[model samples]
Target: MTQTGASRNGLPVEVHHNALLQLLTNSLILSHTTPYLSCYDVLNLAATSRAFRYLVYHTPQVFRHVQLSNVKAAQFSIDGIDRGGETWRNVQVDENLTEDDFYSGPLRGIFSSLRRQNILQDVQILSLDGLSVTAELVHDILVDPSFSVRILSIRDVKNMNERKLRAALQYACRESRPEGTPRLRGLYVFGPKEPAPELLLKPPPPVPVRKAAIPAPPVAKAWNTRSKKALKVALVEAPEPWYARRGDQFPPRISSEWAFTLMACHGIIAFDTVLCTGPRHLNSPAWGTVNIDALNAADVPHYGVATHSLGGCASCGCAPEGWTVWGEDNLATSREPNERRTSGSAISEVGRFPLLAPPPVHSSNIKAAMCPTGQPVNPRSCFPSSTTGKREKACFIPRCFNCLRDRYCNGCHRWWCETCYTGPWATSPGGHGGASNTGADLLLGVWNELP
Candidate 1:
């Protein structure tokens, strides 16, 4: 075991505390219980003692995914969590607080206070909406090695107009990324929250045509007309499988929520580079690199753009470097959406949504995700099947190993369906695992403002 001493954040130094308790909390959170614990439960524990305070705040895992909006002390007071009474009351109120106020002061908001106290010292998935953000702040935060923010949301930020938004994205381009860049995967930006009192909320104002990378969205047509035309097109192309067709117009099917593929070596596989078009956004037609992955999934030219070409090869366990042996999803079958649904295939259990950042996923954390419920999963283990999957230590992919609906691996470019990665492999590959559309679930970052 590691020496029981100081945390990575360098806090509560030389203070006597219970090492056993800290270890227990860390063990339970990582392996057994789940990703999130109730805030009320965590804060109540923090209020109990100083040793517990350091344990809770400095542990880093507790705040793996958090939201700290600028709310007055009174709001928190009503939540029933004891925040040391005087601390909340004494704190000052400020709405337009940016990254500048990360210190102990009257004007500092909760976001800054979290930074000042090193509360976010090890945070991963972070949403900093409502704060007035700047372009330089976003650039510095993403580039900073100290912070491990993967996916960030800066919705409703004040003055985050088209110009500032463009500048923020330009900073994140692979060309501009300096050495020691974190595994920053995706960035989502929606329009302001709580803007109008009476009017309905709206999506983000469209990015200027000059700034956008993709072509303009198609004009809307009558739904009846479009659906009938779409069906005809799918029927004509139904003879060929998705994976079999060469990407004459665009890359294989990909989600707008998921941008480029994050190669195992950490280099991004930009879709626009190899193909004429990129993945369509789930909502709008706007395409973005280092900024947005969004589009409408249903439409001509955009048909089948929202999903991946599944069932290529076994991706979960260790197979040969090249997946020459086809897995179950690769068998010859009808390609029609309706007929394809009936065929036996390895359906990956829905896990974490692609839009969000994954939790602290070391090899140790993966065991929990692999075995979602208390019961053992289908493939049993991600260890190679030929071997007994028995060893003192297990080797798994470090980065890019996630609960992505498509169990895609960048190293081999394969799809590891739920049947392959879980409890035990049946005699027949990809046919049996008992994994359905639901059931298994996860047991499952940062930046600044501009001036």
Candidate 2:
């Protein structure tokens, strides 16, 4: 018997064609392989050697179902649009492409090549991130008779016009799809933007008043909560609160531990525990509880305690002049000793009040700070004295004596009137404040640490 390929126990490989096909078409391998690879990976494999080329080109089943979420478009250029109208003449896949290259990239030649190879007609499942699916490209895909895409998912694509996309999907589901076209079974639209790190974990507080040269897309760092070593490293590297430098401005207050739990319950923060096990308890729905305290106690990564330091004026909400611990009962402030008021060294320790309720402003006593040009400005000028004209505004209307009646912001630590709670920015990047579900008494707010 002529030797083919070696088998176990040092036997000569005499596998039948059917057996070879069965090994290659194993459901477990096929399902597991595509998720960890890019469509370019299949294309590249098809060009590697004669045998691989044949396997990839002939096996439409392997390449037809693709997830373009992990690929980046910047690596490869489209023929006409990005590459100066050059035709795709290369028959070989770039051997230098690394694993990092697997992440999402442009889909310029992906569909075109698939269409030419007659693979597009058989496509049943497709997952596209916002970057891969441009409005124009989506329109083309929907209009093209070749794409029999059954399931479509779009996530975190910026500037994606939902209205037009939905309309196109509706048309494809109703009229544009003809015979041989697979009926759209599901259409899912995930987050319009990537979530901030603070939403999941207590991140290293941001550098004070510092801006990056180039802003990058938000990336949520994965934490292996199961590992204690990983958790220890993450906490050790966490940022400490910085004293306000001469030119720096203070950020918002973070939420209390109890408030964070409430936010977690509302699906605001995507905890790894919640993500892996799921929101509901396995044994009973009512028993579904996130063990935040235990996680924090264990020092698990991203589950650190949320802290808020007292800063600025409690009443007018002005920036503090200087950092000083005046007394146990009250925070102290004053100008630099022996320096004139015009020298810009005014410092004062303002009164500490409940985050929910503001203390009555006594006109006779003001904790004013010196302006940049060395002139004292009343803190009241910094915020709106009256919020009557503004409807649907966020306000911390004091309906009770306790903090329970007031919602606190984990971001600014400023107590907003109830009207400001329901504004568009409530859960947004700059607006990391909780609001009660009811106008009068919902203690809902998260710390806004997102840039």
Name the candidate that leads on TM-score: 1
TM-score of 1: 0.36
Span of 10 residues, lowest total lDDT, candidate 1: 442-451
| Candidate 1 wrongly placed segments (more than 4 Å) | 1-26, 30-44, 70-111, 129-136, 155-158, 190-451
lDDT tens readout by residue for model 2, 175-232: 3457543244333343232233345456546556546556444442223333544775
Q: Given candidate 1, what's the lDDT at residue 332?
A: 18
Where in model 2 is the C-alpha error above 4 Å? Answer: 1-22, 25-32, 44-60, 72-108, 130-132, 158-163, 173-182, 192-451
The models' CA-based lDDT, in order, is 0.36, 0.36
TM-score versus the correct structure, for each prediction = 0.36, 0.35
| Tens-digit lDDT string for candidate 1 (298-337) | 3423212223223333323322111111111221122222
